[model samples]
Target: MKPFLCAAILSVLPFTASAAPSSSEVVESFIQAYNQHDVGLMVSHTTDNVTWMHVTGKKVKVETSTKAEFGAAMTDYFESLKGANATILDIMESGSYVSTVERVTWDNDGEQLSQCSIGTFRVTEGKLAEFWYFPAHACDELSLKPEVAPEVGVLQQTQY
Candidate 1:
């Protein structure tokens, strides 16, 4: 009788579904496209009236007047990369918001500069509507690896 009770309880145990993809996935997709230098997919994830801002509070209003114009702008940015690749090291998600630490590798006058950066994205209805990005800085010599590779960096508290 005890064995039968144990079996019944075990059978009744709930099975949890796999964790759904966080908004970070959207960011990751963008990162991959940026790395691969694919602009089409990068802009497709963004809504038409996307607002991309930087840490300094500078804003770009991407009201392309038409979807085609929007796509062209994205393509132009990608083409301008000239082999620049971005790597996403850490990502954390809360509700519709996803934050990630990234490293961007680009060249200037034959010198290679790898800058560490952090970006947060606000997602709505499966689209990334807006985002805020802190400027990238030179990495410390002691910490060779970017924070996002194995673990996520802790972010300061801010309004969502």
Candidate 2:
């Protein structure tokens, strides 16, 4: 009876593993798409109704939109920046939630602007269902020095 029960559990283990992409994988794909500035590819990894929340520590701004609306926003943002790129420094996953520390650099009419932030994402069914963004600094820590400070910062509490 013990051996039979062990066999049964072993047989069900594979099926019990989630069919959805791992939280790290989902975040990796999203970051890759973002680095390429491929809005379509980015949106493709999101649910039809995705909720994005930008938390400023003081207030939370929520935007619940369809994939189309999200895609449009991405397009507009890219256009405004001329060209932007993101680098994921670290990624941590817990259950279905993935959190990342990233630095984004953009050309704003030849003046480059770079900022670091923490982004938390909730992935469901292999797609992003929700996201929360928290800026690491209240103001852009701009520097023209040749040596740039490391972007990695301690993860603060998020409104997750």
Candidate 3:
């Protein structure tokens, strides 16, 4: 009986692992398509009503765009820029949402610029439904940090 159970579990393991793409995998594929300037591949990962919100690090300001609009903007950006690339630092997933920390660089004319940012994506039905971008500093402030709490007899406590 023990050997039979082990064989059954082993047979199901591969199927379980390949059942569906994780949220992180979907986001990673989108990022790879974006870096390659493959608009079709990037759009294939999103739904028709996909929305993107871009935060400019200003005081409570966000620019919103739809799937078609974002595609056009990305096309223009790729055409105008000399080169662009993205390096993913971390990826986290919870439920249908995936968040990534990335360093993105672009070359324009003879100058290069780079910035670190956090991108949060909502994937539904195996397609991207929404996304939000925030500067790394903003995400840093929101990150979980340990704070010394001498009074609680604890060496450190998580600060939200």
> Which candidate number maximizes TM-score?
2
Sequence-dependent TM-score of model 2: 0.70
Count steric clashes of candidate 2: 0
Q: Write the per-residue lDDT of candidate 2 for residues 1-160, one digit (tens) a residue.
A: 9999999999999998857678899889998998888999999999999988899869988765678888888888888876688887668899999998788888877798878888999999899999999966422453324766777886678897
Model 1, 1-160: lDDT tens digits are 9999998877766533444456877778767876776667777778877677666547544335444565676677656655587877678899899998777787767888787878888887777788777766775522545556544686677987
Per-candidate count of clashing residue pairs (backbone under 3 Å): 2, 0, 0
Q: lDDT of candidate 3? A: 0.81
Native RMSD of candidate 2 (Å): 9.6
Model 3 per-residue lDDT at 1: 100
**Model 1, stretches more than 4 Å misplaced?**
1-20, 57-73, 141-160
Question: In candidate 3, which residue pairs get closer than 3 Å at backbone N, Cα or C atoms, i.e. clash?
Answer: none
Q: What's the lDDT for all of these models?
A: 0.72, 0.84, 0.81
Off by over 4 Å in 2: 1-20, 136-160
- Angstrom error of the Cα, residue 5, model 2: value is 28
Q: Write the per-residue lDDT of candidate 3 for residues 1-160, one digit (tens) a residue.
A: 9999999999999988886888888999999998998988888998988887776656433343567877887788788865788888778999999988887788767787777788899999888998988855533344545766667665675796
